[model samples]
Each structure stands twice: as structure tokens, then as C-alpha cells.
Target: MNNSPIHILLAEDEPSLAMIVKESLETRGLKISLFADGKSALQGFTKGNYDLVVLDVMMPEMNGFEVAQEIRAQDEEIPIMFLTAKSQTDDVLKGFHVGGNDYIKKPFSMEELIVRIHNLLNRKKLQQSSEQFRIGEFIFNFPQQRLIYKNNEPVKLTHREAHLLYHLWNNKNKVLDRSYILQKLWGSDDFFSGRSMDVFITKLRKKLNQDPTIEILNVRGYGYKLIIPST
Candidate 1:
């Protein structure tokens, strides 16, 4: 939320699928480091501070389950998700056994993939020792869906509102493309999604009105921007 994007390490041998996934996540302001095989991906994970790791089951050098085992040994906290075509019971159990927090069968929609990633992240984030973000004078606890401002009653946020605010906070002081946001959050950038996004934005604006320095701007033909003046 402090202008640092969520860093993710992805191990995928399928070039087309990997490219599509990487670009999709990146469009949502995530930082993705892609590796073609398990060994390289494992190496990349060791060299990086990744918030999450996405592994493909079959690959040259090393397979995902094996890679996951190596990663689990080194860092037990980070979220690990498996991507594979195998829907067999044994493969599914093996993935979980190897420290995978979530699994998505191949031929999956981008929306499903994103949702699973968020679920894993939200679960893992709360499981960790700490997780907090600031918007003006307010403390936004995302996983709890609570927005606290001083001694006032906390404003409980809906699921969509929380996600919208999370994206806004991450890209604060910069324009967040409406289309990109719609696709990232609502899975489409159509008229209905745009209108829905607008309503959520309005609600966020009202809740954040306590701080005059904070503003969620409409960038005309482009998108929205959450402005926070430097203190």
C-alpha cells in the first residue's frame, strides 16, 4: 500500500499461458518475475522477496511439486499456488502435500486465477504476524474489512469496496485505469462494471472525506486516481 506492488514469482513452461498470466497480473499493478522451468523459478524465488509463488506442475529440470518442497523448506510463510492440467485426485493431494496453498486446473479463466490468488494472499497475509495500511489519517485493515478513524465507529466495507480501495491505495497518487481496474476486480470493463465501480468509488470518497488532503479523482476520459498529498 506504500507504493510497493505485490511481488509474485511464477514458474510456467507454457510460454503462451505464462505470457498471458504475467501480463494480466501486471496490468493490475503486480510485479511478476517469470521463469520457464522449475529450477530457474526456484532460483529466482531465493533471490527475490516474493509475496507469492505460482508454480506449474510439469516442467523440465524440476517439476512444480518438487520446487514447492524446496521453497517450503526455505520459507514457510509465503503463499504457494499450483497450476496444472491434472485434475486427478492423487495430483491434487500431492500439490497440497507439497505445501501448496491453492490449486487451479489448467484451462482456467483469468478471473478464476486472479480470485484464487487473492484468496491465498488474503489468507496468508492475515496468518502472518502483521498486515496494515494507511489512507490519510485512517487505518485500513483489508482482511478484516474495517476502516478505522480515531475513536469513531469503524466503517465496515463490503468485499468489493475493500478490493477497490486496496487497488487505489497501491496506486495512490497515480491514475488507476478504469478498464484495468474493472477487469482486475469485476472481470470485465463493460458498462455495468464501470457503473458499479463508480458507485464503490463514491462510497470510498465519502468514508475518506474525514481527511481533506485525500482525494479520489476522476481523470475524465481515462480513470481514477487516489491523491494523497505528502505530509
Candidate 2:
């Protein structure tokens, strides 16, 4: 429970329904960005940071399933909910197959919709908390904000350091785009923040260098990659 408003990307072609959904969520202190079709919704998704997406299945230009697939290609972690008139078993399966976290049938009650939204977000929060990442010989306990190695004294990390490490750890062995990292963690990719990120990376390197098998490699003008030995 963070009291901050949850930003949602809502794509529903029906104007009246969209207005009602928007008003309902806004009254509950949630921020909603409404788009009339799937393509516009995809654009909003890319340009704006969102906690979750609510997609109407039948839409012009593209559909909810297509939009969810496109969103999954970018960030698989973001939660997606599908709203559809079809409640067929096949349709529900298809939604889950396309990376939907939750499915809500059309003509649903406002209370039910809000409850499902909260539940999906809460589930994601729980997953993030329980996630334990292995970094070479170290265990990154994200919830505890501690880096534990060989069951020895754990290295306590500052909030920023822990957040940064979580991102790097999640993208281990992959060249994480610098702008993506900055935008996700620091909310900006400006010159000052970029320099600041470098400083944190250097500090992280020093902290993690005790194990020769662990390495954080810089990908030239791209980003940083966390490398951990396979064995």
C-alpha cells in the first residue's frame, strides 16, 4: 500500500463505457489514460509509464489480444487485464496465452472491476517481494535489500542501490538499454542522471568484485550487462 495513484492504460472503443470506467477509477484515486482503439492504446503504453493496462477485446485498428502481445514484447512484467464481451473458455485461454494477467468480462460491475485491478496489482507486488535473484555466489534478497554471499555478513544496500541492483539482476547477461534502465529506475535519462548511474555502477562493481566469476560489463554506448558464471 503505497498511497500513490495507480496509473492505468485503458483502451475501450465505446465512449460511454470508457467515460464511466474512467470516472469510477478516478474517484477511487486511480489515474486512467483512455484510448479509443488498440493502436492508440499501444502508443500510450509506449509513451507513458503505466502500472497496468485494461484492454477491451474488440477494437478497431487492433484488438486487445494484439495490444497485449505487443506490450509483452517490450515489458513482460507489466500487468495486463482484458475486458471482453466473450466469456468463452477459448477466449479466456487466448487472453492468458497472450500475456494477460487477468481477464474481466464486459458488462461487469464497477466494484468487481476495481477489486480485480487491486488484486492483480497486489499479486504482482507480492511476487516482486518474494523474488530472490542469484548473482554468481551472492544472493540478492530484494525484499530485504541485502546482498548475501556464502551466508556471511550481508551487505546492506541503500534504497537506490537495491533498486538498481534489482534491475541489473533481472537482466543478467543481457545488454540492458541505458535509457530503459534510467527511465525505469531514476525516471530520467538526462546527462546528470546518466553520470550518476555510472557512479552507482562503479560502486556496485566494487561491491560485487569480491567474486572473480561475477562481472558487470559496460556495452559501450548502450548499457550495462551483469555477467554471472553459469556453473
Candidate 3:
């Protein structure tokens, strides 16, 4: 996992700027996909896998805000960074309202962008580790990926699924950061992997649904929470 290269999706309309940013990030060994328009970027987002998304605010036919909204509908946890020349407070707030996690103004330095990306990724990684979790009548074995129910049946979990569950369970009563979960499970907070994680979470929810006391809650701007009924 540590050896895996981070994958990034860059949605910028300016061809020359996109190329420069893509090349700059690539030099750091990160995998980048460049899209010239919002439509193509959204389509690629649906079809391809990535770790993080870098979107330009002013784009043709479906601007970054619209694309972000669509992406959020499918995946509530992936990291989203907005890039735009608009510096007004209203514009920035609008980005956040549309589910943007971080914002970078246009004409920004490549070094600053790189640093911000690194910081966001690092922060995400720190939030995924959990000491233990109690789900319904089951106690999760984090390292082993097994759920031991009250009836003593041991439910096995896939590697990725287990990691996802661990993070949710660990954040039992709190908001679990979406970006952190993606980085922890898939090595990047990109669109595709984010969607994949959502699928895994749905499957996990179904498996645990048999226990009425267990529930996975979505916290809008934040992330997820695994609730355990009071004993």
C-alpha cells in the first residue's frame, strides 16, 4: 500500500495549464488524468479510478460545482479540491456548499498545490486507524477482519471491506472523514476508488442489518458513523 502511487484527477479547461500541472505532479510520481472540460471529467470520473480530484471552477457545460454535486451524490467521501480565479468569499463558500474540501486560487504556485495535496492526504491517512469497535451484538477484530457476533458466529471480511469497517466502527460516535477512509483503504482519495468504497460500505451495511442495534449514519459534509445501540 505504501508503495502504491497516488492517482489524481485534474479537471481544468486550460490546455496548457493542465499540461503543466499534470507534468509537475507526475514528476513527483503521482498518477494524473487531465480533462479539458467538465463533461469529459465527469464521464472519466464515472469510468476510471483515481485517488483525488482537482477541479477548476470555471468550466464549460456543467461547471465544477455541478460536477462536484453529481460526484457527491454517488460518493460522499472522496477528497475534492477546487481551483479557480474567483477569490470572493461567496465563491469560496459556494465551493464548500457544493462539497469542495479544499480550495486553491488560480495562478497559484505548483509548490503550494503540491504541499496542500500532501497535507490533505496525510491528514486523511491519520484518521483511518481505530483501536476497536462494537457493532450491534458483534465485536470487530480490526487486524483480523472478523466480526464475532453475540451468537458467536465469526463473519469473515475481505481485506478492503475490513479496513473500511474498521474506520467506520472506530468512528462509532463521530464523523469519519471521507478522504481519510479512501486513502486508508485504496491508497488514494480519487473518484473511482471512492465509489468502490461506497459499494463496499453498502455491502457491509447489509451484512450488519440483521442486527437492528447496528447502523451506519451519513453525516453530510463530514463522513460516516457506526452506531451501537445501548446494552
lDDT of each residue in 1-231, candidate 1, tens digit only: 477999999999999999999999999989999999999998998889998999999999999999999998887667788898986766765675566666777799999998878876775555343356888888988766679997899997654566778889889999999999877665457664566577679989999999888999999989999998776
Every model's TM-score: 0.56, 0.57, 0.57
Candidate 2 C-alpha lDDT tens digits along 1-231:
567789999999999999999999999999999999999999999999999999999999999999999998887677788888986756765676676766667689999888878876765575476767888899888766688888689986644466678778878889989999776544347664566678678878988877889999999999999998787
Q: Is 1 or 3 the stronger prediction by lDDT? A: 1
lDDT of 3 at 65: 93
Segments of candidate 3 deviating more than 4 angstroms? 131-231
| Deviating ranges (above 4 Å) for candidate 1 | 129-231
Residues 24-115, candidate 3, lDDT per residue (tens digit)? 99999999998998999999999987778899999997799999988877665567888889867667656765766677777999998998
Candidate number with the higher lDDT (1 or 2): 1
Candidate with the larger TM-score of 1 and 3? 3
Model 2 alpha-carbon drift over 4 Å, by segment: 1-3, 133-231
Q: What Cα-based lDDT does every candidate model obtain?
A: 0.83, 0.82, 0.77
In candidate 2, clashing pairs total 0
